[model samples]
Target: MSLFSRRKLSEYEPNDHQYQLNKLNFKVTKLEDRIDNLENDWECASQGESFQLANGIDAKEAANRVEKAAQKALPNELKKAFDEINSAVKNEQQSIRLWQYKLGIVNGEPQWVRIYHIAALSRELKKYGYETKLDSNDSDGRFSSLKVSWEGKETSDISKIDPAKKYILPLEDTECEITDSVTGKAISHEVAYACPRDDKWEIIYERKIYSDAVVVPGKNIISAPNWVKSIEPIEAD
Candidate 1:
């Protein structure tokens, strides 16, 4: 029997409640999991899916997909970083310029040409143009501005990205038991690395493909034996 009964699963019915529960009742799960551990587990593993941190790439990819649905987009800082180096190279006009011009470095263009490029792109960004502008007042170069668009109707000024999915990637190793089909023997494989699955917001490991690394999304991934920091061979001690 459950030690706590705030509401049963049936209470959250044929609506948006399941996802909402993941958001609203997620924290409570830590405590619930602990209590269930101390007693008979009321939180059944038979449920569709449990939780883990979605890998970082998975989260970032999710954000990028959303941005693309809006239109072409570029993070402002990406451009600023390019500028800081390009400008540094330009300001070093000391004696390198004569030679740089000879070598056709940066196409021998002056600062104005670069700035013009940014301005022009921003002006027509809504029509599938992209551009960046540096903030002279900001020495750190963090305040660079970016404009990107492809549809000529809507443009995005996205300075930040947030993952839409609930999973956060696990920081440490995940442990599991694997039964060898050939021998019908239960063995253990510790996950050393994990990556995004082809499906949306899913994760996989590079199991068996490389001898040193154990894959994350194998047959037994759902039945976690115990998540731990080290999956060292059991006989190591």
Candidate 2:
């Protein structure tokens, strides 16, 4: 029989409880062995050798002498340490203006210009009924944002677009798992790609021809996974 009760697979329990118990048991066993060894060593030492005092000095008197020596030396040592600290702080403050200017190099105009260009592109895409999506690239690279056109055709004139009416780019659904592609050994996860050609949404190209990375030109098809029998669209708060 096991030392612990058999927990059913269906039973509700904290995930790491058993792993934590195993760790605690290992630590307790190690501590017990260390304490036993220490006690044995102390008993052997006490019986094996005798302690002797130099110059016939008693233990209490010797301790008192050591205390006095420390008291005499400690104050001078402390003052030297404090003087070194004060010197460092003084030097740092004297050169602080130069240090502060070096930090300003990171907030330069080139960085601002890069950000301004990306924002301008995002704003321009919004006028063409295309919302700007952040790319999958880690550094964002040369392409700062992706222009997504779901319905095709420009939603409004570039000059007439209201900033508030701008559509947000559709975020990729992470919860959807690539079932067939992962198991069957395919390059792409997406099953199909849809695009608008003549006012009608159609699956212009099938899978294996291209990956989701190849934009469908008009719309980025992010459909529900096969595992999901039904999905309810939720309103943002």
The top-ranked prediction according to lDDT is 2
Kindly report the root-mean-square deviation of model 1 from the true structure over all alpha carbons.
Answer: 27.5
Show model 2 residue runs off by greater than 4 Å: 1-17, 50-61, 64-237
lDDT of 2: 0.36
Candidate 2 C-alpha error for residue 69, in Å: 4.4
* Model 1 lDDT per residue over 129-210, tens place: 2232323334432233333322232222121112221212222223334689999787755332322344322223333223
Clashes of each: 8, 0
**Alpha carbon lDDT of residue 118, candidate 2?**
33
Model 1 scores worst on lDDT over the 10 consecutive residues at 94-103
Q: Model-by-model lDDT, in order?
A: 0.33, 0.36
lDDT string for model 2 (132-168, tens) is 5544343534434332333333332223223333211
| TM-score of model number 1 | 0.16
